[model samples]
Target: MSTMDYDEHESKFMRKARENPFVPAGMAGFVGIVAFGLLKLRSRGNTKMSVHLIHMRVAAQGCVVGAMTIGVIYSMYRDYVLKPMEEQKALNHK
Candidate 1:
């Protein structure tokens, strides 16, 4: 293969493997489900919110709650998962 063609192919592969800078489809669906389920409980037993509005409102609430939940969990995770490793590294470096 020519050098230019190889470079182009490698670049294309790298681009394909790159992380998406947006919420993924399954994660988005989970957020939507949680938000919709939370906001859909109305005063009337059988009433339902409009489908589009339910999804929209839930998605917004999902973004807010999801961020907060993630932050809390990440803090716990770093404390439990990384703090010991950091201390160990410090000890070894001494």
Candidate 2:
């Protein structure tokens, strides 16, 4: 593609990424799950390092799935219900 077309596509992607509502939730969930898992493993003080690392990986994956599920539900609600109501309000105000 031409330079202009590439630039436009890149900007559109960047804008969508910025506007994505799930990003913050997913990041927070991932960090919290991994941190908690590590802390719990440390406290237990009996598990092998390899086992602990495996558990951490599992926790992180679970966090991603859980966060994505929550984000999808919220996004669906916002798109189906909240956005329509807000648009109607704005239209009525005009």
Candidate 3:
């Protein structure tokens, strides 16, 4: 008899990958746009460097907030829903 190699052990990894959705596509594009705008705003004019740094920091913070929203949504779904289902399924498997 030949040993069969079924990917039973990989279902969890696949499930977790599917369950986690971090940073929506639109938000990611906004982050890239902010970064690009910052690059354009890299002026060496009479303005103090610290002022421009603060502007960049504020834009970066907005991007972080957008990213965190995705994280929060993913966490809520994964922790409250998918996790329990996976646990139950695992128990049934055993």
Which one wins on TM-score?
2
Pairs clashing in candidate 1?
none
What lDDT score goes with residue 40 in model 3?
A: 63
Alpha-carbon deviation at 16 in model 2, angstroms: 4.2
Model 3 accuracy (lDDT, Cα): 0.67
lDDT string, candidate 2, 1-94, tens digits: 4556445556764655555667666777789878888678757678888888898888788878887788788889989999999999999999
Tell me the whole-model lDDT of each prediction, alpha carbons only. Answer: 0.61, 0.77, 0.67
Give the per-residue lDDT digits (tens) of candidate 3, residues 1-94: 2224435566654554444545444356567767775776756478777787676667766776766787788798879999999999999999
TM-score of 3: 0.42
- Model 2 misplacement above 4 A: 1-17, 32-44, 87-94
> For residue 21, what is the lDDT in candidate 3?
45
Pick by lDDT: which candidate is best?
Answer: 2
Higher-ranked by lDDT: 2 or 3: 2
After superposition, the stretches of candidate 3 with alpha carbons farther than 4 Å from their true spots are 1-19, 23-34, 42-47, 81-94
Q: Considering summed lDDT, which 10 consecutive residues are worst modelled in model 3?
A: 1-10
Error of 2 at 77 (Å): 0.8
Q: Give the TM-score of candidate 1.
A: 0.38
Off by over 4 Å in 1: 1-52
